[model samples]
Target: MYALLPVSPLYAGLALVPLALLLFTLVVLRWRAHEAASVGMFAAAAVALAAYGLSPEALSVASGKGVWDAVFVLYVIVPALVFYHVIERADGFEALRTRITAFTENELFLVLAFGWVFVSFMQSISGFGTPIVVVAPLLLALGVKPVYSVAIPLVGHAWANTFGTLGVAWLALVQVVEMQSVAATALALGVLLWIPNLVGGLSIAWLYGRWEAVRYAFPMVAVVSLIHGGGQLAAVTVIPPEFANFFAASVGLLALAPLAAWSRYATPTDAIERRPVMAESIAATDADGSSPTAVADGGTATAADAADPADDGLMSLPMAALPFVALAAAAFVTAVVTPLSDALGSIQVGLSFPEIATSFGVVTEATAPYSPFSPLTHPGTFLLLSALVAFVVYRRKGHYEAATARADEPREAFSRTVLATAIPASIAVVSFLVMAKVMDHSGQVLVLAESAANVATPATYGFFSPLIGSLGAFMTSSNTASNILFGGLQQQTAAQLGGLSEPLILAGQSAGGAIGNAISPGNVILGTTAAGIVGREGDVLRVTIPWVALVGALVGLVIVALNAAGLLGVA
Candidate 1:
């Protein structure tokens, strides 16, 4: 039987309906991610059932897969929320701010340190929009203008999206594409991201102090990008992709303090002529949590001379930093150490379903277990353990003052965390995954790939591959979901091209998806909401789109060069 008006251009065109609706509600209607995604999911289901001839049982199984996928997503998100709350309540963020500021008083280096290095580091540990939530406020507290505060982190963290949040995006890419050369794909992705890391550092500097400031901070930018990119390349070669961002960003953060201390990139001795006064940069926030903006006259404040406010007689550096340190260490050991990986991985848990076939003759294979989530080894576990360890340490250090301890109260913290994240996040996860499942099981994605393969030449396709991945994320607002939606398509299209490198194509896709995050409305809104600019989403997107497009194009060029060299499919 024909499915969805036959496997032709017509059916492929039908496949786009769900995606179009998703983009419409999300971008034009300005709907929340969950709401738009839910609407899209239903639209996808209808297409699958009526046009594609999906059996009810198969559809049910697909929905089950989505919920199972949601479980994997929520495991990381819920724990990350708790972990962030734990740190915020204990004034760990303030401690971090004080330590970084003490390292360098220069505005340029400080922006690079927090906006580039630290933002990437946070993305590694707590992704899915967590980095912006944490780093944007840190920038604001450091006296950065609201627009710069929000925009800088969005740009700074773009390079880390695929490997960040403990490789959630990487996992999704591999799982959907079902590739054998995962290590090769990881290496290619790490190499491809070199441009973004380097460009992002320079971009941050320029955004802060313009072209002159970029020149001043140029050395730091080069060094930071090398450390970050090199670390990721080395880590992916040795370990799993999940640890790539954490390992690399850590190397970058460690290297940054020394570079700032020695280089004197923006020190008063070198650049008194062009320094932007630190105080004049911080936008005064309104009490109603409206958009905090820069002063019309660019006035200065006395607070610039003071270090970020610290808790009196409490919250020392080690006490505050130890929890995060533990978080990295735990996630690393559980994932990298073979014995621990096997031991923890053995306790696999998830749902299982029998195979079902649609009337269109598309068959989903039976699986004993699906979307398996390991309790001990998962990032969620690491985050929880880190939170508990930090909590005990903070209590021991007397960090729980009644006035400063809003996040310290367990009931309030948990309640607030759930109330804040549960609805929007959970809805987004389930609906998006269901949408992906319906499209995938209905053979819509395969037909789309076949169509692309028919029209694209190997060389030109390489030039546009990353752009394809970017489109997926722009619609879905998740690099992981982007991978799930298009990873198989990329692989199939690469296979059809004969000499084209599948890994390289995958790399470009991953890189494109990462960069796409900068312009993703869902994420931009997250940053805006955090920075108290809930209505100026257009302002954030206007700046981010140009950066993302330029970087994505650079990645596409790299992919084409690799294709010409015959290195793409060398394996």
Candidate 2:
């Protein structure tokens, strides 16, 4: 093996330039995601070539890998948008929205339901930003402002990033890092992630109406957090990690009924109804006799013209929920059924890349199959199946056929919506992923991690460990990728630090990566695209960043305290 390049302050600082520039462009300049990601991609390429001595061929391989990865993400995006449009054309959302309002008109409780509980449920089953893409618009349909609509789910589902999606992120961490105690790591992560789970629920309330909303929603948030976080912890100890999040989130979803039945939340409170985060009431109509719905650019759309229920007949709530039910069933079978999951996962697709090395000797090993994708088990497959099921069922029910002359044909509308939303989103995802690959291949990510590790003492290393993982997630916009990039580093650093519990530190790393999804540019773009607020990514970030930081810092302190108290190790 060639000796790796020595880390230095100058090299580390140079390594950080792309990410710094990305943040500046995104948050300060308020550039659209595609624009900002493209700029960052070029910056990373420059830094990789000039400072890290990355070979052009290696760069090509990395970029190609990034493109391939983007395809995986796009698979979900395209089908999800198709599924969304299919539902929209069937007037399923209005039916669902009506059902939700009928269940409880308390705005705070409504926000928590779609934003926290339902989004968490989505993440548990299909979490490649699926929760945000699916739930944000539902919130908007309930008359929430577009920005908060996107932001709410962004924060709400972040805590599930590590263990959700059938524990893909957790499995990735295990694959990359050799751990002394897998069970301990799982338990620690279960405990640590609870903070964000709790914080995310409360944050949604706070975002809706500030302190008053929090006070109003506190009991419900507590109950949901217990089911979501505590239930996950309890489940993980006895059940397999893959089933933990799904069970917990499913229970949370079930609990919502009773929670909504509680006297306080069952009736509309005038105080809670006056939501600061929602747009004008859904009943508000423009002079043209159309109901105004908030659009992403702070504009209103005449959605009511199409969405208003007519005498012909609206889809029943069960029919409206059919697609998601199908989606959940498909995901459950593929993820939880052992024989079916194995058989479906047997046919995998991946590309092989030759071992590549930078001039400085950082090496990426050659593999027969890199990042293999099992198409049948993928979230995209589930989404597409759901879309197809929705079309057939809705058509049979005469929902789509009943559309007015003004409405486009269902198939044509679905195709148009998918193309419009997926194309720009694909570009942004590719740009962001390629930038992440370049940074990783160039040893820039390593330098950043090592620089942080080197700067911290054992006393302070716990605090910095999760931050490194957060940095990785911010760059990659994936907890799985973040763990793959930094799991070993976190493990090695913990060993080197001495007295730090490896499991605790790794748990912190996982927890930090989980929460970081809230502010990841790729994730933000997914939310914005789904909510029809594509360019206002900066606004969503502005809302989510503080929550992420707050949750991340709390995770760090928990790590520190656990380490100090000698509770980090497995008994």
Best by TM-score: 2
lDDT of 2 by residue, 1-571 (tens): 1257658899998988898888889889999888888989999999999889898999998888888888778888887778877887777777777766778777788889989999999999887788887888788777788888889998899888898998999999999988999999999999998999999998888888788888888999999999999999999999998779999999999999998899999887766544557665433533444334544355223232234444346677798889988988898777778899999989999998888889898988887688898888888888899999999988887887665432544244556757776787788899999999989888888888998998988878889878888888888888998999899888988888798989999998988899899988778888887777777888888888888888888889888898889895922
Give all candidates' CA lDDT scores.
0.73, 0.83
* Model 2 steric clash pairs: none
Residue-pair clashes per prediction, in order, are 3, 0
Lowest lDDT 10-residue stretch of candidate 2: 299-308
Which whole-number lDDT from 0 to 100 does residue 58 have in model 1?
86
**What is the Cα-based TM-score of model 1?**
0.78
